[model samples]
Target: MSNSVEYQQSGSVAVITLNDLPVNSLGLDLRTRLLELFRSAVADSSVTSILITGTGRMFCAGADISEFDNGKALTSPLIPEVFNEIDACPKPVVAGVNGAALGGGLELALACDYRYAHPDAKLGLPEVNLGIIPGAGGTQRLPRVTNLKVAMDVILTGKPIKAGKAERLGIVDRIATGSDFLTGAIEYTRVQTVSKNSSDQIVDFKGNDRSHLEDMLKSLHPVREQSKLACAKALDIACTHNLEDGLKMEWALFKECHESPQSRALQHLFFAQRQATKVPGLEKTTLPRAIKSVAVIGAGLMGGGIAMNFANAGIPVKMLEVKKPALEKGLASIQSVYESAVRKEKMSHSQAEMCNSLISGTLDYQDLADVDLVIEAVFESMDVKRQVFSRLDEVCKPGCILASNTSTLDLNEIAAVTKRPQDVVGLHFFSPAHIMKLLEIVRGKETSNEALATALQVSRLIGKQPVVVGVCYGFVGNRMVAPYSREAFRMVLEGAAPEQVDQVLTEFGMAMGVISMGDMAGIDVGCAAAEANADEWKGDPSYQALQFKLKELGRLGQKTGHGVYIYQGREKINDPETITLSVELAEKHNIERREIGQDEIRKRCMYALINEGARVLEEGIANRSSDIDLIYTNGYGFPSWRGGPMQYADEIGLARVVAGLNHYRESLGEYGELWFKPAPLLERLAKEGKSFKDFQP
Candidate 1:
C-alpha cells in the first residue's frame, strides 16, 4: 500500500489510517491507495469490521484543490468512486472524526455505517464556500441522517459545527468518550451493539417537510448568484431521490458548478488568499518579534478601533490622546462597542469584560515607553503624522515596532522622521478596525524583515487578513479606490441619477452603489481628502465639481441628512435639489447631461479600477494581481463571486476590457480622455492575447 494510507489489524478490527500530513486531502494518489487498503481489508476474513481515521488534527480538509486547476481532479478512481465503494461495502465501516471533517471529508464519513467524533471535532459540508455543493453522497446521506433544517443550515452556510452539535443533529452517531479518538473508534467497531440503518436505507424526509425545505432555500439571500444554483440542487437531491440516483445527479451538478466562471473565481480567491500570506525574500524560518503589549496614539474613532483589535486578541493596550476629554470619549466609545456586542450575544459577557479591561487610556506619550509596538492612528496629515512619529521615536522602547495608520500619506517620508526607520511599518486598518478583516501591511523602504514579520504575526493574532504592500499613496486598497470612486461621481455628473448609478452596480454584484456609499461615508470627509491632495488634480479643475458644490452647500451626507441623496429615516429619497445642482455644474463645466446606460456605467467604473490595479502591479506596489483582489474583496465591498477586479477583468478577457476603455475614451470625449486610458501593462497583456493571470508579477 502507498504511504498515504496505512493498514493494521487489531484482533477482528481492521484499522485504516489516513497518513497525509497538513490536511488529509483526498488527492489521486491518496484516494487510489486508500481504495487498495480497503479492498485488501475486506478480502481478509479475519477482519470483522473496519475503522478509518486520520493521523492528526485534520480528518481531512477535502479534495486536493490544486488538482482542480488541471484534469487530475477528474482522473480515474475519483472521489465519488471511493465513496461509492465504501458505501457498497458489506462489512461494517466506522469513521473516526478526530478533527475537522469538511467538504468531501464529511461526505467520506457519511459513506460509513457509523461515525464517531471527538468532542472537539468540527464537521460540515463547506463546498458552497468554494462555489460548489458536495458532489458525492453528501446531499442525500446528510438529509437521511439529519433533518432538512439541519442539512440546509450545514450545507448552505458552509460553517462547521462542533461535535456536540453534530451529535444532537444526528450527523454523528456518537461522541467518542476518550481523548484517544482512534482507540475509541476501534473499540466501537469491535463491540457493535447499536443497530442503525445505513444512510442509503433511510428515507429522504417526511412528505410535509419538502415544502418547508423549499421555502427555506428560497428565503436564503445568498450574495453569490452561483450559491443559489448550488443550494437549489442540494435541496432537490436531498428531498427528491434515493442515494443511488442522487449521487449520480450530484456529480453532474458538481461538474456544472465547477465549470462555471463564478466557481473558477471563487476557487481563485481561495488560493489567492493563501498565496498573499507569503512575503517574497522573507523565509518561513524567520522569527517575528514578540508583541507583548501595544500603544495607540490618538484616541479618535480609528485609534479606538485599532486598540480594540489588540485588546480583543487578549493583548494589553494603552490608548493616548493629547487631552483627557478626547481620551475619555475614546474610552467610552470602546466600552459602548463591547456593551453592544455583549447585548447581541456576539461576544460573551466575560470575554467582553476581559477585552475592555485590556484597554487603558492615558494622556502622556511617556506612558507608552514600555509598549512593544506603537501604532499612530492620528489625522491623515503628513506634518501631524511626522510629529507623532518623531515623538514616538523618543518615547518608545528599543525594538518597538513603530507603525503609522495613515491611509494616504507617504510611509517612507513618515519613517524618515523617526530615528528607527527600519522598525517603522504601516498597519493600514480599515474603518472599525476590530471588525474589518483586511489589514494592509505597508513595507517602507528601510523596513526590516523582523518588522514585516511582526506585523504579519500581529495580523494573524488579531484575526485580520494581512497583505504586504510596497509603500505608496493610499497603499493598495485606497489607492485603487480613487479611480473607481472618481468614475462613479463623474458618471452621475454626466446625467445618471444617484439611484440609477447605484442600482447598476448593485445588480452587477457590488455590495452597495458608489453614489449611496459616498452619501453614507460622509461626502465632506471625501471632499477633505480630495482637497488635501489638490495638487495632483490641478490640471482638471472640474474634477469632483458636484462633490465640492455639495460640500459648499453644507450637504455633508448621512450625518447631515442631505448630500447626493436626501435621507428620510433609513431610506434615502432622490433629492431634486442635488440633481438641479448637478445639472447647473454640468452646464457650467461644458459637460453634457446625456443618458448613461447600465452596461457603460459598469464597464467604466469597473475597468477604471482594473486599469489602476494593473498600474499597481506594473509599479510593483502589489506583488500579484490576486493580492489586489484580496484587498478589494476584504477591505472594499467588491463581490467575492466576481473574484477581485483583476480576476473579473481576466474572465471577461483583457482584450475586451481594453476595448471598453478605448471605446469610452472616444465616446466621452474630453472626460474619457482624461480618465479612461488603459494602463500600459493592461494594454500590453490584451495585445499579447493574455490575461492578468498570465502576468508574471
Candidate 2:
C-alpha cells in the first residue's frame, strides 16, 4: 500500500481507497499510487470490477495546487497520465464518490465506466476560477459524458453542480441514499458485474451538440467562438469547432490571460493574499468560543454589508451606528442589497426577510455587551478608528473578540489602546462585504489564538473565505498595489496613453486596465494613500510628488467628474485635455517622455508588485504562498489561473524576471529608487535559478 493511495483485492472486486486526508488531492504521490493501483487492478486475474472511493468525506477535491509551487514539480505529467490509464482500463471501473469530485477529480470520474455519488456529493470542473483552463481531460471527457453546452458552461465558469444536477446532466449513473456511501456503491457494483454486460463495453454519453453544432459553427464570429461571455449569444461553440480546436482555443485564451498585466498583477495578488495570515511565530490553535452573536460598530457600507453576511449565516447581530439617521441609512442599504439578491434569484424573499430580521440597528454601544464579537467598520482615518476602538474597549464583554474593518491601519496601535491587546484583531472585508468572498483576518502583535479562531470561524459562518494576515500599514492586498500603480503611472509618463495601456491589458483577459481601475477606485483614494505614505514612510519623495500635485489641483477622479480622464455618468469620456495636462505636468517636472510598448508597460507594472511581495515573504508578513493567493483570488479579483503573483513568478522563471528587472533599472537610470533593488531572498533564489514558487509561502 502506497502512502497516497492503495488497492486490495476482496474476492472479485478491487477496493481502491484514496488515502489522502481531508480530501484526497491528485498530487505527485497520489498520481503515482493511483497509477500503480490501476495497473494491478487491470492486470490481476482475481480482480474483476474496481471500486474507487476516498478514505474521508471527499472522493477527490482535485490536484494538489500547492504542489504547483513546489520546485520539484517544474516538470511532472502524473495526473494526466494517471487519468489516461484510468480511461484505457480494460475492465469496468466504478467511482464511489463519498464527497466532492471537482476539476481533475470529476475528470477522473468521467473517464470511469460508471459513477455512483453520495447524496451530498457535488461534481464539476472548476479550473476556470483559477484563470486557467482544465489541463486535465475535462475539456475532452466532459463533452463525451454530457451535452457540449453544459460542458462549456461547467468548463468556463467552474461552478460546482450538485449530485442531483450531475445525475440530470448524465454525468453520474445514480445517487446513493445511505450514509455509508461505499456500501451503497459496492452493492450496485455487485449487481452490475453479475449481469451479462461485457467488461469491455464502454459507457454511452450523448452530447447535446452532437447533431448540429458542427453546422452552427459556420455562422459564428471568431470572438463569439473564443470568448466565454460570447458563448451566451451563439449557444453552441463546441458544435462549430472540433474538440482539438476547442482545446486549442481554451489554451490560447489561457495564454492570453497569462500574458495580461492584470493576470500578472492578480497572480501576485493571489499569492500576496495567502501570505496575509502568517503572523510570525504565532501558534495556530483552536479556541473554545464560537461566534453566535456579532456586534458591528459603524453601520456604514462595510459594516452593513458585513452584517448581512452574519445574518445570512443565521447569526443574530446588533448593528451600531453613530446616530439615528446613520442607522436608518445602513438598514436601508442592507435592504437594497437583499432586494437585488432576490431579483437575481440568489436568495428567496422569505430568506432575505429572515436575514433582515436577525440584524438590529441601534445607537448605543451598551447593546453590544454580550455579543460574541465586535467588528468596527469605521472611517479610514486612524484617529476615528482609535476613538471607536477605545469606546469598544470600555463597553464590549471581556471575551468578545474586537476587530477592525479598516483596510489600512496598524492593528497593533489600535490594540494598544484596548484593555486587552490579545483580544483585538483585524478582519478586513472587501467592499460590499455580503457580495465579496474574501475576508482579511489580521492579527496584531498581542492578539491571542482565541481571538484569531473567533475571527476565522465567524468568517466561514458568514459564507466568506477568510485568509488571516499580519498587520502592516496597508495590510497585504493594498500594500502590494502601491508598486503596481507606481509603474502604471510610470507608463503614462513613458508616452503610453491610458487607453492603449488599458486595451493591451483588457485584450490580455483582465476585466479592465489600470487607468480604468484607477478611475473606478477614484484618483483621490490613491492620492490620499500616497499622501499618507509620504508622511508615514518619512520623506518618501517620489510618492510625495504625485500626492501633493494631484491634491493641489483638486483633480479627484469620478466623484469630481475628472482626474486622469473626464467621465459623464458611468461612461468614461477621455478628453485630449487630460493627455495634454499630463504631458505638461511631466514637462514642468522636467521628466522626459519616451515611447513605451504594451509589453513594457505590463512587465514594469506587474514585476514591481512581485518584487515587493518577496520582501513581504522574507519579513514574515505571510506564512505561506498559498495564503497570499487566497487573499488576492478572493478579495481583489486576482485571477486564480496564474496561481497568484509569486506563482506567476515561478511560471515566468524568477531568473528571467530578475534579469528583466535589472534591465528596467538601467532604463530608469536617475529616477530609480535603490528600493527597486531585488530582495535578498529573491536575489539568492534568482542566482540559484529558483523562483518565488520555491518557497511555498
Candidate 3:
C-alpha cells in the first residue's frame, strides 16, 4: 500500500488518516491505497467502527485536477469506486472533514454514514466552474442530504458553504469544535449504531415538493447555455432516477462534459490564470519592497478610484489635486462609492466609514514626500504625465516607487522626466479601478526588478490580477484592441449595421460589442489613443474615421448621449444617422457596400484580435500566450469560457485561422491585405500544424 494512506487502531475504532500533504488530492495512487485501507478496516474483527480523516490543513481538495486529461485518472478504484467501497462497508463509517471537502472530497464525506467537520471546513461541489458537473454521485447525494433548492444553488453557482452553514443545512451532521477532528470523530463514532448495510441509509427525498427547484434553475438561467443545460440535466437525473441509475447517467454526462470544448477551454484558462503569476526568469526568493502608504496625483474619477483601492486594502492614501475644490470632489467620489455599498447592505456603516477614513486629500505635492509609492492618474497626454512624474520625482522621498496609471501612453517617455527611471512602472487600472480585477503592470525598459515586484505584490493586496507586460504604444490589451476595433469600424463601411455587428459579437460570447464598448469608453478616448500612434496607423486612412467624425460632431458616446447609437438613459437606441454616415464614408472611399453575414462579421473582428495577440506574443510585449488571454478575459471583457483569444485560436485550429485571414486579405485587396496578413508566428505555427499550446514564450 502507498504511504499516503495510513491505518491505525484506537480502542474499537479503526482510524484511517490521509497523509498526503498540501490538500490531499486523491490521485490514482491515493485512491488505490484508500481502497486497501478501507477493505482492511472492514475485515478486521476488532474494528467495529471506521473514522476517516486527513492530516494537515485540508481533508481533501478533490480529485487531482492535473490527472483530468490523462487516462490514469480512469484507472480501477476510481473515486466513485472508493466511495462505493466505503458505502458498502458493514461498520459505521464516519468522515472527519478537517478542512475543505470540495468536489470529490465532499462526495467522499457524503458516502459515509455520518459526517463531522471542523468549524473552519468549507464544503461544496465546484466542478461547474470548470464547465463540468459532479461525476462521482454528487448531484444524487447532495440533494439527498440537503434539500433540492440548496443543493442546486451550491452545485450551479459553485460557491462553497462554511461548516456552520453546512451543518445548519444538515449536510454535515455535527461540528467538531474545540477538539482535533479525528479525536472528535472517533468519540462521536464509537456510540453510533451499526447498520446491516450503511449504503441503504442514504437520505431519501423522493416525495418532497420540487417547485423550489424550478425557482433555483430560473435564478441560475443567466449562466452560459451549456452550463445551464448541464445543471438542468443533473437536476433531472437527481429528481427522477434511483441512486444506481442516477449515478450511471451522471457519469455519462460527466464524461461528455469532460470531453467537451467548453470544458477544455475553461480548464485551459484555469491553468493559464495560475501560470500567469509565475515570472519565467525572476528569482522566487526575490521579495518586493515595503509599501505601507501610497499617494495619487489628480482629483479626477480615475484618481479617486485608484486611491480607493489602497484605502480598501487598509493602506493609507493621499489624494493630490491642484485646487481644494477638485480635491474635495475627488474625496467625495471616493466616499460615495463606500456609501453606496453601505446602502446595498454589502458593507457595514462602520466598515465604510473606516475605509473612507484611510483616504486624505491634499493640495500640495510636498505632502507626498513620506509615501512609499506615488501613482499619477492624470490625463492620457504624455506632457501631462511627464509633468506629474517630474513633480513627484522632486517631492517624493528616495526609494519611492513611481507609477503611471496611463492605459495607452508610453511609460518609458513618462519615466524619462524623472532621474530615478528605475522606479517608474505602469499600473494600468481599468475604469472603476476599485472594482475591476485586472491591473496591467507595465515594466518600462529601465524599470527595476524591485519596482516590478512591489507593484505585483500591491496588486494582490488590493485583490487584483497583475499581468506584468513590457512597455509598448498601448501595451498588451489596448494594442490588441486597436485591430479589433479597426475591423468593427471597417465592417460598418462594408454594409453591416452597428447593431448587427454588436449583436454578432455578443452572440459570440463577448460581454459587449466593439461599437457599444467604444461608445461606453468614449469616442474621444479612443481617438486620442489612436492619434498617439498615428505613425503606426498611417497606412490605413479609414481607420477609426467614423469615430473621428463622431468626435467632430460632438457625439462622445454615453457621456454625450450620442455616438454609434443614441442612448436613452443607458439603453442604446438604433439611429438612422449612423447608417447614413457609413454609406457616405463608403462612397467617399470608392468602396462597394454589400450584405455582410453575421459569421463574416464574427470572423473578421475575432481574427483581427487573434492576429494582434500573435504579434504581441512574438514582440515579447507579453511573456506568454496565456498572459494575453488573462488580459483579455480580465481587462477587455473577453469571454472566460472561450479561454481568451489564443486558446480560442487553438480550438479553431491554427491552419483554419490562417486560411480565414488569407481569405479576407484576398477578398479586400490592398488595404485588406496589409491589415489581414497573419503574424509570422501564427503563419509558422499554422504551417507546422501546431496550436498556441505548443508556444513556449
Q: All models: lDDT?
A: 0.87, 0.72, 0.87
Between the candidate structures 1 and 2, which one is better when assessed by TM-score?
Answer: 1
* Residue 482, candidate 1: C-alpha displacement in angstroms: 1.1
Which of the predicted structures, 2 or 3, would earn the higher TM-score when compared with the native? 3
Q: Give the TM-score of candidate 3.
A: 0.96
lDDT by residue (520-558, candidate 1, tens digit) is 778887887678667767767778888899999999999
TM-score of each: 0.97, 0.81, 0.96
lDDT of 3: 0.87
Worst 10 residues of 3 by lDDT: 195-204
lDDT tens digits by residue: candidate 2, 1-697: 5677876666688888998997898887788778887888888987778888888778999877665432333245557657666766777788888889987798778767789998889998765454345655566566666656677668657799999988998888999987777778887665555321212232233554444444444553343123333322222333445444544554445445434433444445544544544445545656537788998988888889889888988999899988999999999988998898899999999999899999998898888889988888977888998899899899888798888998878899889888889999898998778888888888788988877877766776777777777888678888887777777776675577878877776664445676677767767777767666665445334442443455567867787887777778988877686677567667766678888887887788677878878877777676666666666656655545455677767777888778778888787765554445677778889898876656654
Model 2 segments beyond 4 Å from truth?
A: 1-20, 24-54, 62-93, 127-142, 178-183, 193-280, 490-496, 504-510, 536-554, 624-630, 655-669, 673-675, 695-697
The deviation in Å at residue 208 for candidate 3 is 9.6
Q: After superposition, how far is residue 355 of candidate 3 from its true place, in Å?
A: 1.0
Give the candidate order by descending TM-score. 1, 3, 2
